[model samples]
Target: MNAWSNDGLWLAGIAAVAGLTASAASLGWLFSRNRYRAAVPDSSYPPEVLESLYHHSPIAFALIDRQGRFLDINRDPADMIGYGKHEVSGKPFLSLIAEDMQEAVRGLFLRALQGEQISQEIKVKHKQGHAIDLFIQTSPLIRRGRTIGILAFIQDFSERRRSLERIRYMAYYDDMTGLPNRQYFKKRLEEKLASARMRGSMLAVCYIDVDQFKLVNASFGRDFGDMLLLQIAERLSRSLSEPGDLARMEGDEFAACLDNLSSAEEAQERLQEILSVLKEPFELRGVPVHITVSIGVACSGGEDDAATLLKRADTALHRMKENGKNGYLQHSEDMDHVAMEKLTIQHEMRRALENKEFVLYYQPQYDLASGQIVGMEALIRWMHPERGMIFPGDFIPAAEESGLIAPLGEWVIEEACRQNKAWQDEGLLRIPVSVNLSFRQFTEKNLTSKISGILEKTGLHPRYLELEITESMTMDVERASQDLRELTEMGLHISIDDFGTGYSSFHYLKTLPIGRLKIDRSFVRDIKQDPSDAAIVAAIISMAHKLQMQVVAEGVETKDQVHFLRSHRCDEMQGYFGSPPLSSNSAHALLMEKVNRPALPAYH
Candidate 1:
């Protein structure tokens, strides 16, 4: 028989395989009504060629009899269910479908028999009884103006379905710790919030921060840091009983949404238990390392939304850290006031930088032996137009948190260098101006280049500029050593500020090419009264002198404290005892007096 002539099966099969909207039933009616002389196109292939394509096509094709039994199926569709063409030729087509979906599949087949095209996704049973997803499209095969069979085009959909599942998993989960990410957590929080609101129940949201995790990351290596994070995640997972309630919000930070809470007190009790469990030391690389967390919790109120509740918890966390870490704090109204003040300050700092409202106040550093002003530290002050001068303590923490410190620090260095050069141009005695470097500025990449550019732009000699870094910057000793070495090579001076207040490792201290150490005010304030502070001051001064580094005592107010520092051979002192941080013009006047007078100022 000629496949492409008379029967019209070739057109039906081709249209079904090509997924065209033109069904064989409608086409057969059109041809019969028109009595088309060109029923088979002149360009139609030979009968054998059409038959070969029907059996060998990669696409799964099937012909079903009016009884819904498989009349003929291509190799691909047979292989889809682990069967061969000969084996399934006489079997009922619905037997290949999963039992639960067989009725739905039969309805669709009946609709196709009624001259309606059917397309749907259904699960079919393989030879091994496992389900395989398939996208099947069926069309009624019309012969001589009546339906004889159904043509189906089947496509394996299991791979695409599995791929979509993997994509969803990645989107909702943290790849490193395998916990819910911030987006997923937020979604869950919203769901829980809706449920709690409906039931007149309360829930709690918590924001947790790992104390000093950055220091640990710097001290150990990133690989070890990752291991520590994984351990922390596991511990948190074990602590929380509810699945999907806990999430890794960010680096060293986690959040939890606690539902089914009877009262805020219950949430607190549960958090306390978690804290107790965390008290046990974590074993990483066979070493027991102690870690602590600071958590902030906010219980849901009658009108709380997810974002508002989360912010409240974060505010509480900040309060916990401010009050000192290794503890937790409950969100209160007062904390919001504090958080608002901080936000206002941060906003003002941005404007202050843009408007040049931030000014440098110079505090004179006196040489203890020579009674002469040698250097001065640059202190930042916000000269608010209406509020007078706003101090560092009021705004610095906000700037640090808001990521405004890097640009502010750069401005400070540039302004200090420019002022120092201006003083030199006016014939004032040459004195190095020291600028404190914030942690963000110190750790930023290409810091040496930044400083070098500032010096070149201001036309100031590098020797007359000093950069002060805190002891925390030295926690990564090797990197610190290399960074400091680069600065020294450019002839810039380096000083360790607030030396005893941070990770004070004497062994790490000896490796850097630091020129000065400033003893913290806490020690110097009680140096004469407290024996331990006195001993610490004495040791710091002695050790600094031994290492050929100059010591500067901070906050030296009383004459007795200055006398003690002088007796200890402290190289310099800067505090109210000498003079409080001065304006640029005042500092220049004092320098001029030192150059003209035989005797220095009163305190000296």
Candidate 2:
């Protein structure tokens, strides 16, 4: 009975404790819910959230009056403007804006107060007198369903705007010369064209290229070349004081747009002045280095646009190069036709390789002393399917410009080798076959490999293959020397063609692995008539003999030319008089007959 009573008392005590715990838990829950609700203000909701319901509470906010005066400002607004609450309570918002933008600020505030939203780029002055570019958005502040003040959101955009301006300048200006570049030039040219069309004024475009600049760069190094170019830019800038635009089109090339030109002659005179100024020597690294320029001038016609004008200028520049460097040429209808023809030729040449439209003509080279054939030069001719035969003069330069010379050169080498091997197989004694290498081919990285591969494929001895490179082609001495060494090691013969035409540095010639020097046809053609030509030819032949190198006279068209070359002990001769370039079969027959014929009597 005692144990039962104790158990029942314990249970009753436990029940009483549980009932108190439940009441306490319920009160605590109610207190926490109320505390949470109180901690968060009703106005804590975002503007987007509050717009869905009517809620009001105190927070930092601003309200500008219709006249741009502060009707009501919160503590945050005063902090934002670096002012006390009372200081901005009734102050005009325009007072905080930059002086130059006060009227704009007033107008924006008025628009917002009139029930319109305003967004604008503006400047605001800080208490320190510094102006900040700002993006501001103002909305109407409504009370009792009537607009009374404005609420604005501001952001700083000074850095972003400045960055954009910098990018704009970079896009339109040449970083090196600080002049308007091609992009800016084109933009200005378009504007000028539009104005000129209305005013019936004329404009001219001139393209200028530094003559023999590659030679300077090759000889003096690129740093000196850059210095030279900078000097050129300065001189060019000084040369033009007229209202015109100048731009560096590319490396060692520049263009100018001359607006309000009265006539082509005036444009020509201006270009001449520019060219004359450019001709002056530039002091680079304390050394005065002279440079010449070629100018191409084009004037705007009724049908011309900016692109057409530039094209015309380019065409004129090409004509200047063709006519000989260091002069100016004006664009004409004839130039346009030539440009179109070149375009057509370039397009057709792309197909020439695929169509196998090229043929090899051999010009026999004679031993001047023996009057016997020693070798032949392989000349390329384009057998245009529809246009008949086209001389190299018509299309070789075009091929070079289009970067097709390398492949075309490979074709020439392979064909020449094959023909030479064929002649050898026909019991004709093997003779060296020389092929003129274009400047593009000589500079190609794969030149040696291409020649070696062709010789190996055709089973022709490398000694029987001679490469004739001009003096200008060897400007890159180190590279050319390396290439020449590699070629000579493979048993191929190398000769410097047109010896006196370019800046022939005898010092460099001695270093090259060369076997012969071919006097230029220009010197040899008039050797019999002009003492100057004779003297040059004689000097060249004499120099070649002293250097233990052979000399070949080209363009020996008359008996007198032949006699003079013989007197000079010239080693070989090739020209129209000996025989023009002949077909492959005829060349083979001639070679056989010459080798078999009795030697001519020595000149008495």
Candidate 3:
């Protein structure tokens, strides 16, 4: 015989004895593995085979009587509950389940005893009093359609459950600050925006940037910076009202959304409170540090979306930073227009560089005494195919903000050097050409080397390529002096542009290797009318001469202004009175005229 008979009492006896690992195929098969309708004593499998299956099966197996008492259990099931098979035998099946879950498990046991198969997740109790998550499948053991016992297959689920929880946390939370991260914040803001649109209620989104956060990180080390950020997050979270959500958007920046506001003013009031609270000092490792934030807020309107609202808030924040940080601003329609224009300019400037839409315009600088062109200053103009000629004022600020100044400045330098060499090669006068340098470009580590390479590539003498740096670039005199000395050592002329307008230190001026100072146009524009302006220009010229540096007056428009500068002994001047910035081709013709003049006055 190969199998047990399909009889109730005979099958129940085998199930209780063997703890069968396989799931029930039929009601009788669950209890005794019966398929052939043979007697139990005549089964083909040996007792040793059944014992090995019961002990070594990966899935936990348990057999319980109709009364819900443990009839027998396999080694896996016994180990899962921290018990020996003998200890569990004859005990109530609910004894191994968590106390709070036993009643629900009891209902499942009863259902299984009624010849139904079931699968469920449940919590079980281990011998050490910890809860273990488990998944179980139960089937009834029956004979002749009468239920006799329940057979269960069990598996541990705790590890997988923990993995899911960790994944959720990582997705929704910032591990460093314990605040919701950008992804979570953006999702939540979108939901709030939708709700506000439906209810016609007011909401505000605030974008915040920590002012001088880079300085903090640099001075205090990253560990202290991390601690400070945590403190800041905690304060921001606490200060925010119940109807609002705060999130860490990125390094040194946070985002918040306020809901259920009565009006835009109400949102502003709430945000102001948050700002006030953050003004308090934070202590890290027994040292106190004070920090301020700039905030930009946008209130919900009739049809605001998340992207538009965030962009408006971010734009407001940017303006606040520009106006000087440690303050907040609300978005206005005007700001949107300005932002869009700025964006368009930024986008076009990059394309302008790539497509050669940018061209150099040379404004001739003449010797005040000789009435002759001594040199020319190279200026950049963006000839946008669509917008026509765009002056530096309209696009230079955008370039500085977008970090396009580095490449833009490099191009101007190389082009000026190349043009000067081209003029000299054409048998024209070899006059030096000056190009203005942005402060950011002036501070570049490779500034000197970059200029040297340009001179070499253009085949222009270093002395014929003058670099103009503004006074603001000289605030860090030590560093500026180092770079300036390097350029001067390479035989390039160095001049300070808009000289007296910035915070200049006369003490450091003597030590720098500067050859010339360009008086700010602001002082010269009103010198003919404003007596103070005339005095300022005169003093500046005298100071330059005393320091053994030549002076050039900018914006010399009228003849009276020209005579004043010449009387002050200013070495050179450039303005519309001489010529406005001219295109390269026009400047080349002008230079040729100068070279061809029968008696060109000697250039100073």
Per-model TM against the reference: 0.82, 0.78, 0.87
Query: Please, what are the lDDT tens digits per residue for candidate 1 over residues 1-604?
Result: 2122432544444454555435565655533313333555535545555556665556766778889887766564555778777778778989889999999999999999998888799999998889999998877777687887787888899999999988998999998999999889989899999999899899999898999998778878778888898888888888787869899888899998778889878988889877887888887668788999999999998878888899999999989999999999999999999888888888888988989999999998888777778888999999998899999998888889999999999999999999999999999978899999999998888999999999999999999999999988998888999999999999999999998999998877789999999999999999888999999999999999999999999998888997888888888898997888989888878888777442333344
lDDT assessment of candidate 3: 0.82
Could you give me the TM-score of model 3 versus the true structure?
Answer: 0.87
Better lDDT candidate (2, 3): 3
Give the candidates in order of lDDT, highest first: 1, 3, 2
Which of the numbered candidates is closest to the native, going by highest TM-score? Answer: 3
Clashes of each: 0, 0, 1
lDDT of each: 0.84, 0.77, 0.82
User: In candidate 2, which residue ranges exceed 4 Å CA deviation?
Assistant: 1-61, 71-87, 210-244, 248-252, 268-293, 321-328, 368-372, 474-482, 499-513, 522-543, 557-570, 589-595, 598-604
Against the true structure, candidate 1 reaches a TM-score of 0.82
**Tens-digit lDDT track of model 2 for 503-572:** 8998767888899999989998888789998898999998888888999988878888888888878898
Better model by lDDT: candidate 1 vs candidate 3? 1
